[model samples]
Target chain A: METAISGAILAIVTTQKDKVASGVPVFFAKDQEEVQRTCILLSRVLKAMTHDLENGVYILVRH
Target chain B: MDKTIQIIILGIIVGTAARIYMLRTDYRQYPSYPHGIVVHVSLGVLAAALASLAIPALMEKEYTAITFLSLAAQQFREIRNMERETLSKLEELSLVPRGLDYIEGIAKVFEARNYLVMFTSLVTTSVALWLGLLAGIIAGITTILISMYLMRGRFVRDIATVKPGKLHFENSLLMVDDIVIMNVGLEDQREKILKDGIGVVVHPKNDNGRAILNNLGQRQAILHDVSILVGNKLEVGEPDLTPLMRKDVDTGKLALFVVPNEKDLECVIEAIYRTPILESAAYYPLKSTIGKSAAD
Candidate 1:
């Protein structure tokens, strides 16, 4: 499987296969731009909330 | 009254007094309230009495009386377990929980204090029995002062320089003195943090200080102490408002970001300095031969 997650990058998505398999809901992005764009988009679609972990991860959790 | 009996009585009184002086409910509110104080003092008196009797009993060639000291040791171990369990349970209710490392350190201190009381009494009684009343009183006072001094532990300010840092946002990232704390996507939250947040940068003086600061448990303890003193500005569900401590990997400096109810930076810094260095998290690299050579 070509995993979308790459070394310490932050991202936002509807769901991730690796996260599902591991039973931990997290997403990764290649850079800050991708993280911000994906998070803004996902917040609208999922009607959830987006939070930055400040390290390099963005969390989209149900409010 | 016999000299042995007088010496034993004096020893117990001095030892119990020393133990009572050491018992306090400071920032870490263990041995809580009237009931807790009563329990500990009672135990302390019992330990002092047992230890004081040992010297006189041995002087009279009563060898079996030494077994009571071993029994007292067993009782003190149980006290340690009680403290650890109670603190662990109370931790669940804490807003900023003291980590397990801190809890263990506190429990160990409590247990060791009882043994210190016993030892103080034993020494006092021995001195009086061998020499005289005046010598015993002098020895007792000196021992109590020494025990009090030994109980005083090092604080964060002993090894680090804490200075107030300016909080600023650089392209959606919150920075405290060039150290990135977190990224804020919400404009409203960012505004709040900017208005109310206080930042402190702790620069470690030596390799030992750096190692201690690197422990996550120690960092969490600092955050907890600071929050408890100044009051945390976070609500139950607001994870975004959580205080953070981030370390610069290169220079070993740690930056703290907190939104306190009181925006007094000086008070926050004072509280940080007063935070007790947890025993388990203490790292003394300077004590080693290799580290000594490196420093030189």
Candidate 2:
């Protein structure tokens, strides 16, 4: 059975970090499916709130 | 009687001490917290020099043996404490996921600046010899002060101090200080998700209570997340994703990552570009955004 997508919360870098630096994390996830689903939801919410968020690189491969 | 020999010896003592101070600051390990060393050490050295100048008779009692050794021991204790504090800071840096790049770049810059700071002290020795002990100490102290100021301003330490805020969450509605909506998305699209590819299709709904009737002659408008009802599944060998390999310390193959299509990704983005209309109640009012920024 496919992993049921679930919503979760995660914080991301609100500003630019150095080339090798990762932004300070303010969010967490319960599981992989939850995190993925939350990420998808977040993409929409951010686009609705701010359009710059939509300009991110999305990587997906056909199964 | 000329004091040329005494002046030479005094200059050597002062110059060597100053040089050593500059070197200590130059190579001082980072994340030096509880940091009272810079001001304290400079003050101590200057005080010692001033005392020697005020009463040159004290220098004749062979005070170098016990005094210098004790001073060295105290300085050693401070350095050890500093090293331990630095080790703790380094440990904290490792725990944080991001900012590794920023930290590394900052460390390199500090190393460079340290060299420049130490180089300035060499020039001070010549001035101290030609001028006097007081003049030499003043010039050395000035240089150290300037370098310290610059380092504090430019050095990369930690993220701009974070303050704790009251966070609240609800079902479907999350509020993070003043009603803010969260958003997320990926950059992949596909007809069928073998791994994690997105599927986009047009879902045209039929009007009220019409199960048999089709909506707008098959499909009138395209919408995101409408692929569940569309797209045919693979009949034969279970649809699989392309495999990927990565280098590891030991021999091991990496898990495959699915690539999303550009079209589907854009479609979802377009859908999100449409600001979220406040979904209240059916009988109540639905707050529709008349093409305005989401913040408003």
Candidate 3:
């Protein structure tokens, strides 16, 4: 049985960029509303699922 | 007509009838009309021809023709591979692909149906040659009925109970009753899910049922079938409405969440109940002594 991660975080959209590390592409938003818009746009562009980290950070993952 | 010719034609007709009876272009929309039907019927005729020839060849002391049955078996095996390949290739582009377990079950069914056709013809021809045409027709009808009964596999309803579950959001986490499905990052998406989503809980009746539900492939099959039947809101670049199933760690109950085109809770529950229990995912651990002892 081969085991590997089925999904990967393609992009991160966050209001607090200080909390997120920089490996994958990251988008910074000014507020909660901006964060939602940016997350939706990034998810659409990346064609990935937007998952809430629930701490002002959203990660786009392709599953 | 000559007796052998009569027998061959009778077997071919009976076997093809059996195949046609088993072939359903139902909600699954499989063995797609016209072309797929034509392919399968042609194969059924070929299998019936091979099987119907067997008894007559033996009656005439022509033993060499018996080897051809093995050749036909090889042909049927190739058909299984052909089906698997076709379905697997088609799966790549599907929004909700039927998992490998479901595909294997379908392919196996295709192969087995061919064998059932052969058996029906063989029995029909043998009984007709030994007894009479009337006896042969009776035997053919009986064999077809038996084959149909035997081919019917257990569905999810046999092992589990399905009921509508409450869909709610605990912050960003989507919950179907007590089970947490996944996190929705977008506020609008969460609102859409709240407005349109349907939640269902599948409670297994026994340890065997629990084990089968535990299979990821089986869970996926349930999702795929439910999506196909009820129609899902899932689309390209929109994973927000993607249907998901999550299990309770404490209990074996599965919680399914789907944003269906039609938000009829009862229809979704019915779709869940009707999903065929995949053959590969079937588990009978309770049949073992150790498992039985541990269950208590």
Candidate 4:
């Protein structure tokens, strides 16, 4: 009986479960180029590590 | 006493009943009703039935007007179902409230268009059918063939667009607050939807993250909109937000290598592994359900 009253519209709005923000600032870097360079270097290192891990070889061996 | 009169009246009654049944069923399955298609279809069938009765008499042949309207109504049902599937998906993504719908009584937008298109095709075919039995059969066959194409082909987008005051998902409409968002784009359509359905903490529009979508060459467009969730593995320390790796050299000094973006799609998977859920029960973006090539 009460189901119709709390359909999709009600459900999305009435999130009884609140999402607590960890307040872990997703953004930290103030400089743009530094952030980009950081992200790029991090990405490259991750890529090489992953390749070594998948191929069962060390980066030095691959090099 | 006249055959045309009898046929026309019979068509009206039968077609109307079928439509009512179809609409009732749609209401049962979908969260919202397909108002536009139902209204257009119901009226269209009634009009066609009356027209078929008169037009055939004037032209001196049997018309499939009633049958066509009835069939078209069924197809409208299919269209509404597809529309609802999209809604259910968005609903899952949006995490609607528990007790009151922020969106209620809003009908799907394209239903009417879809219904009218089918009805018009039906009427066109019925006219052809009325020309003769052969004409009717040929028209009916052709219509059926086309409906099959429309049913399977990715001919239209089912995504919602932003309106002045409301959001218009393909068939279903919604009130502003029916979905989740971390931000709301003001004064424009670009990056508007990114802020809705589900949004991550870091705006993909990070002053530094440059993303571009190349439509295989016809055009290139910026696509900073990430379907990332709040707590998903995000590389915190940068150059690339990738996890760190270190090596020991001959002098026992520590060295490190960073991940690259292109190869980082691999890192993306790793990042995916490292990423935690944004919220305890947060919903993921549903836009991923649709196939990509279909959009192209």
Label model 2 with its docking quality class: incorrect
lDDT by residue for model 3 (B1-296), tens: 89889988899899999888888787888978698899999999999999999989999999999999999999999989999999999898899999999999999999999999999999999999999878998999999998788878899999999988999999989999999999888899999999999999999999999999999999999999899989999987898899999999999899999999989988888888898898899999999999899787
Model 3 clash pairs are none
**How high is each candidate's TM-score?**
0.82, 0.27, 0.97, 0.26
Q: List per-prediction Cα lDDT, in the order shown.
A: 0.81, 0.31, 0.91, 0.30
The model with the greater DockQ, 2 or 3, is 3
Q: Model 3, residue B82: what's the lDDT? A: 92
As for candidate 1, its clashing pairs are A10-A29
Model 2 DockQ vs. reference: 0.05
Steric overlap count per candidate: 1, 27, 0, 35
- Cα misplacement distance, residue A17 of candidate 4 (Å): 31
Q: What is the fnat of model 1 with respect to the true interface contacts? A: 0.15
lDDT of 1 by residue, B260-293 (tens): 9989999999988998888888989899999888
Off by over 4 Å in 1: A1-58, A61-63, B292-296
Model 3 lDDT, full chain set: 0.91
Better of 2 and 4 by DockQ: 2
Please give the interface root mean square deviation for model 3, in Å.
Answer: 3.7
True contacts kept of each: 0.15, 0.07, 0.80, 0.00
Candidate 2 lDDT over residue span A11-56, tens digit each: 3422222312333232244544544454455544432111114323
Q: Which scores greater on DockQ, model 1 or model 2?
A: 1
What's the true lDDT of residue B149 in model 4?
48
